[model samples]
Target: MPEFDDLRDEPFEPEVLSSEIAFAGAVWDVRDDRVRYGDGEIRRQYVAHTGAVAILALDADGRVLLIQQYRHPIRHRDWELPAGLLDVAGEEPVEAARRELAEEADLVAAHWEPLVSSWTTPGGNDEAIHVFLATGISTAPAAHAREDEEADIRVEWVPLDAAVRAVLDGRMRNGILSIGVLAAAQRLRDRG
Candidate 1:
């Protein structure tokens, strides 16, 4: 049996007693919160994220779609997988992933599978990101109009081998992108 099978059992979850907005930002909000831990109460400041999704879109030739977009916080453009926030009201994570794929790459997939779920920075934020693997790709019927920083994004398709190299060589440093590409590659390898 896999180690993950043990994780199926429910675990104790800390209950938040009170929370207040410390700072509200365009992308994420900071909150000052108090929670009941195992046997004690604690107060901490953390980011209350809206969560997000990332897509590892693989074409017929095993090339993965990547995007170079300006990240204002880091003050640099990064090569990353197609992704977006789950900020839309009543939208599912997979739905957000599909929307982001269309909006970012203008591509659609006939097949979709869950790849990984992770907390981008659990120590300081509640930002959880779910990644997906999308294959059997084609152009979307209608491309979404980009705005703000999204308008300046550049899209490219790089072979999987090259992407792995980039990840191994520290060139692809985006957390989500690095996680998605490596997991997708490992999944493909495991399938063979």
Candidate 2:
């Protein structure tokens, strides 16, 4: 094991001079903030989001669950993991992941492990997604009705190796899905 001091995290917190809502939308809010950086304060505009959760659902055969959904911003359909927003008041991130898995894929996972977490767009958005590796999966009693984008999504199970290759080949455009798949692959390899 490495030394404790070497593994310690250095805390660095910046001071926010001021912040205000530049625009408010139904899904997200745009905020303009002035913060102290280095020796001066700079103003930046970014999206304030409620965060999200994603699940990399796997079966006994090791295939991974992927969803094909239409993203209006990109004007195309892209493959992604089962995901949902943390908009429900007082709901935990993991609970959101479970809810998304049931809602989008109609599956329930008996084993769930934290895989990875990342900021979807750190430079422009404060949206962070926490992804989990869910195995020992089975069909749920009743899948929840989807709304909006989720209403038209198609779910499928793909081989882990093939999914990883798709992510490396730029076919998998969703950042959360890519990161989660890669991390899950690495963890699987390490276990073997």
Candidate 3:
């Protein structure tokens, strides 16, 4: 049997980092996650949520599509698959996945398969990034993005072996996107 990471009920100890959204004037609370590990002391943890999406797009020729975007937080451009946060209050996780797909790729997938769900930075944020397999895509104009955002996202098709090679070669930067793409590619190869 394949082994999976097991989580158990633990404790939370928090220290407030921020109490406001500085730009939007919305009240927001940010805290540090502390878990009991050794000798019942506190260990810093990542707080994650179930509201993020990682879309794996496979085109008509079975080529995997990837995006290159400038992430200011990291100070440079990184090659990654399409992904975004599912921040809408009343929408399901998959709903955010579809919306992100349309906005980022400007394409709609006729078929979608939920592949994997994971946390991006477990030592800080508790964000769960739901990865999906998207096929049978058609292109259109982008639907949405942040007003001040200028994501010069380059969409290009990469062969399966080449994509995986890039990941192994340290070219793929996003952790979750790398795992999502490799997993989806493996499944596709198995099916073929």
The model with the greatest lDDT is 1
Which residue ranges in model 3 land beyond 4 Å of their true spot?
1-29, 33-50, 141-151
True lDDT of residue 122, candidate 3: 65
The candidate, 1 or 3, that scores higher on lDDT is: 1
Predicted candidate 2 versus true structure: per-residue lDDT over 1-192, tens digit per residue: 556766743667689999999999998999999999999998999999999999999889989999999999999889999998999999988899998898888899998888999888888998989999999999999978888887898888999999999999997878888998999999999999
Of models 1 and 2, which has the larger TM-score? 2
What local lDDT does model 1 show for residue 37?
Answer: 90
| Clash totals, every prediction | 0, 0, 12
Query: Candidate 3 residues 1-192, lDDT tens each?
Result: 866577554666455433332233232234443444545646343333445888888888878878777888898777787887777888887778788888887778888989888767765666778899989888855555644333567778887678888888887767976897789877977989
Off by over 4 Å in 1: 1-10, 38-40
- Please, what are the lDDT tens digits per residue for candidate 1 over residues 6-75? 5653556699999999999987889999999988999999999899999999999999999999998899
lDDT score, residue 105, model 2? 89
Number of the top TM-score candidate: 2
TM-score of 2: 0.92
Q: Which stretch of 10 consecutive residues in model 1 shows the poorest summed lDDT?
A: 1-10
Q: Relative to the true structure, how large is the alpha-carbon lDDT of every model?
A: 0.92, 0.91, 0.73
